[model samples]
Target: MVFRPPFEEFEIQLVEVPAGETVPAPTNPGPLLLLVTRGAGSAAASGGAAASSKLLAQAELRRGSVAFVPAGTTIKYTASGAGDLQVWAAAVNAKVFAPATAEEAAAAAEPALVAA
Candidate 1:
């Protein structure tokens, strides 16, 4: 078994979503893989206005749940109960150092993840 990437520029983020709080992370530049390691919660991918956004996808997260977040999508992690929710997020083909662009901003503003 072997895995190969065109370039080796990615990030593995150890995220902790506190109990009963919504945390907003920056828009991902590439595909993202998420795995819940502890506690319970839900991962939501949304786009559009902040006042009234639409959910692209919602996945129930547990101790061993997995979710996929696409590029140019904004994801929010929320923890339930009294303990924090921990998850490991791995971004592939990620351009973490790239500057933000107007097109990118607009794409993020009107995100729509389609399932095939």
Candidate 2:
């Protein structure tokens, strides 16, 4: 499926991931702004561990906090502590750059894919 931004300026998706769940990775091309509203989670890029890196700009985000993530950066998130992992994912797209296909996104997200 194509990941088309919902809004004209940016798309805001209020996502809720259950406990012990982790978001795999993006399957399209777009900048993501993840605003944590409740619970705890860890974000890691392709060459990092989900719980070992502090790359993602974090915030208390209990009520109001936000973090901006650039495009082409593959990220994996694992929820910690209690409560549901709630995040507001803002997707932005520029006309100059087209979205990546599912295959491309998968290849980019994987860390050990041998180049052919």
Candidate 3:
């Protein structure tokens, strides 16, 4: 997955996982923050097991859950049901790695004098 980090802003990524598919390993060791927007699923890491292999996070996420993935922790995911598993994920210090900037606008044209 690709995350876009804005200037003085957080990096964001939308993930949609099919049933029986797990999220890939972490390419980097960073703090991951996920917010469920659509479907639900289970998540885990090197420290613990997923929440539920069939349901979503009805209550608070456990330590091994996706919400508790600490820094330097290797992360992965597992789909719950046939429905999709959609989430919004972000990382800490994303802006530090790569930041965004605004583009400058062009100047207005000047009017010319004409003879009658």
RMSD of each: 11.4, 11.6, 11.7
- Per residue, candidate 2 scores C-alpha lDDT tens digits across 1-116 of 22446445665666666777877666325667778887777655553231344654333344355666666566666676577777777776443365788997898799886678
The TM-score measured for candidate 3 stands at 0.55
lDDT of each: 0.74, 0.61, 0.55
Between prediction 1 and prediction 2, the one with superior TM-score is 1
Which stretches in model 2 have alpha-carbon errors above 4 Å?
1-7, 47-63, 93-116
| Candidate 2 overall lDDT versus native | 0.61
lDDT of 1 by residue, 69-109 (tens): 76667778889758899988888645545666999878888
lDDT: worst 10-residue window of model 3: 54-63
Candidate 2 C-alpha error for residue 79, in Å: 1.0
C-alpha TM-score for every candidate: 0.65, 0.56, 0.55
